[model samples]
Target: MGLGACSTQGPFEEKDRGPDRPVDTSHVPDAVPRHEVRTAAGNKNPYTVLGQTYHLMDDETGYREQGIASWYGKKFHGRRTSNGEVYDMYAMTAAHKTLPIPSYVRVTNLDNRRQVVVRVNDRGPFHGGRIIDLSYAAAQRLGFANHGTARVEVEIIVPGDQPPAPLRAEEASDAVAIPSGEQTYLQVGAFSTLGAAEQQRERVSGMVGYPVVIHSPEELPELHRVRIGPLTNTTEVAEVREQLRRNAIEQTHIVKE
Candidate 1:
């Protein structure tokens, strides 16, 4: 597949980032321990492309904002994603349903005021309410791994004069909402060794509330992965991604589930 050329545009500016802030997971309540629950139980893996009709807007460029954001990991690590790439769960990445492949967005965590830039590479987080699904590492940077979710803001960043249009009402309405867990998901990071993946998992576990898990990759057998959640709400997902960026772990992307 040919990579769409990114127009030569303005210089990429590094956003202002504060010092590393840590979330105390020790006080978290009734939370499942890291590596305790192997899979997100009763959670149906979403992402069925039903071949629904979609419209193309003449205006394919602009910025947008959505609600909360969440994340995923473990269960999908190393599997072949919809985009045909292996899932990583540990790397800085995300999931979106309709955005163009390899687009860039700045995710801001509203709660603590943190932001992370993520590449839109894949589709999903179809459960609803979520705009983006981040990886374990990205979630840690936004400080949402502790609380499991966060209110976030997602704004698109495109080159040249063309920016992607916002999700139309019909399209947005047909899109999934929160409370549903079966939305599409994105996985980040595919390491050649289990030990390397584990190192990333360990790094995230210590920084936030959630415990990172090592998922055995099916397609990329030589790789091990780390991931976070099955977030359906786009709003929540966007928020969480921003927070993770503020805390650190800024190099992230969005992968379709």
Candidate 2:
């Protein structure tokens, strides 16, 4: 589906009976990490669609989120996606609003606990309340093809990151704590105006429940940095980064103090 104009209606209304036939999904494997050279074409720093502008993420490390997911089927088949690749409904690919094109993400269906890793190569679902848009085959594998939408979790799979082991019943409810000495901070944005910095600090503090501080460096008195920390570790930093991204805060710098 084109990110610029994603329509709910399919061009072939009659033949688009969904992926009703059983097809071999053995070849449809999860997206693996490789040394990818990013180009400037589809990796638009700031792109406008339907009048609203979106800023793409510079890195996909540690990005995770939970939201409603929708899918595109035969309607967009054979069409070129935002990344210039021809859209294949049967491929394990997806469209994300702000994720870097060609990134890999692990999508989990919350309702059924089914998971599938998909390569994000396009931008969209622009419709309200949807986070990621999956291909028809992906949706079928996740068991949401018949339902049209599902509550899902999308987590970025960085290179060298191992797949998480299944959690036991007791372990699922426990929180993972970072070591005391390993704390870090992520400075999400900075502003020359203290009010702007305070406003952002307050907004993000409410979202993550962590102390969002306005730090003014002695060397750079004019700059007020809006920072969130002391994050337990890199994992926490990644989780907070994803939360901030959902709130439209994209620019961030990890700081070790």
Candidate 3:
């Protein structure tokens, strides 16, 4: 997909950060100084931000409740987020202020009871009253893309526990269902500088409609490409690819890892 298409199709534009545009935090917060820590002698990779103590997820980690949910797309297509991944606002991913990255959650639009399963990949909904942010695809699945936001009940779905199947696309509001096929994921972007990648992560945190995450190269320890999706199969890749193209991110290449 080309950036032009992604930009024109979505509600927000990266350059058009609204009149009341909030302060941008792409640069590291003043509190987090730049530093590097060493690992065992043979290890060349230094520990980045992953070790910072985060709030613990505990028994309190089951189903969650009421709050406003919002959808984001286009404006942040290629921007780095706080979590170190480039944002793709069109996948079945999301952002939650406290949910652990990569955890699964079931989001229900309480007004319509329309629901969708999403992965918690990034941190956010920093705006008051907003509990979650879904990708464009997830919003459409829940029947809210045209309306933009909705009151919702976000339930934390334990990985092995599948909440009742989310209302099918036709049953919801004519939104398209992710086609059934082989499971796959796609790499969207990657950077040698963790800070740069994180900038893209934060940019998407506010605009995505599903669980969007930023994984550390350290954790996956490979080629280090930023990725989006728990895409059920390869067929869905084209739709996702289109969204990326529309966002002006035409160079985004597909990678199984």
TM-score of each candidate structure, all chains considered together:
0.44, 0.58, 0.44
lDDT of 3 by residue, 1-257 (tens): 11112222223222322213221112110111111232222121222222332352544356587887776665555555444556655446676655555556778888788777765555555445677777655776777766767888988765434443353333344334444663345555554345666766665444433344555644433213456666654445555655654554433444344
Taking the tens digit of each residue's C-alpha lDDT, what string does model 2 give over 1-257?
66644554332222343544454333344555544667875688798877778998866686899999988876677788997887777667899989887788899999999999888888887777789989877888898776788999999887557753354332344456666776567776655467777888888888786788988876655457778888775556667766876775645666667
The local distance difference test score of model 1 is: 0.49
Writing each residue's lDDT as its tens digit, candidate 1 over 33-65 gives 111121322112332333332222233257577
Predicted structure 1, TM vs. truth? 0.44
Q: What's each prediction's clash count? A: 63, 0, 35
Q: Which ten residues in a row have the lowest lDDT in candidate 3?
A: 25-34
Which should have the higher TM-score, number 1 or number 2? Answer: 2
lDDT of each: 0.49, 0.73, 0.51
User: Could you give the C-alpha RMSD of every candidate to the true structure, in order shown?
Assistant: 20.6, 18.2, 16.4
Residue 53 miss distance in model 2 (angstroms):
0.6
